[model samples]
Target: MLSWVVTFLIIALIAGVLGFGGIAGASVEIAKAIFFIAVILFLVSAVVGLVRGRSNI
Candidate 1:
């Protein structure tokens, strides 16, 4: 998921350099959304793991 966000970011940069304003904007937005989603999922998983570990003790 994080890799995808990075991929899109690179694509956006390239597109912007190539003078594709619309494509670059859309790609950037997509990258941002994916990055946030990945971060949220990571946090949720970490919390779940910590809670489960405590319960096991």
Candidate 2:
């Protein structure tokens, strides 16, 4: 999931460099949304692990 965000970020960078403004903007937005979701999920998982006494984390 984090890989997807990085992929979209790279795509946005390339699209912006190639002058595709609309594509770049859309990709950037997608990247931001995915990044936030990933962060939220990570935090939730961390909390759950702590509460459950999961040491593997």
- The candidate scoring highest on lDDT is 1
Which digits, one per residue and each the tens of the lDDT, describe model 1 over residues 1-57? Answer: 989999999999999999999999999999999999999999999999988786534
What's the TM-score of every candidate structure?
Answer: 0.90, 0.87
lDDT measured at residue 37 in model 1 versus the true structure, 0 to 100: 95
Cα miss at 41, model 1 (Å)? Answer: 0.2
lDDT of 2 at 28: 92
In model 2, pairs of residues that clash are: none
The lDDT for every candidate, in the order shown, is: 0.95, 0.94
- Candidate 1 has an lDDT of 0.95
Residue range 6-34, candidate 2, lDDT tens digits: 99999999999999999999999999999
RMSD of each: 1.9, 3.0
- What's model 2's TM-score? 0.87
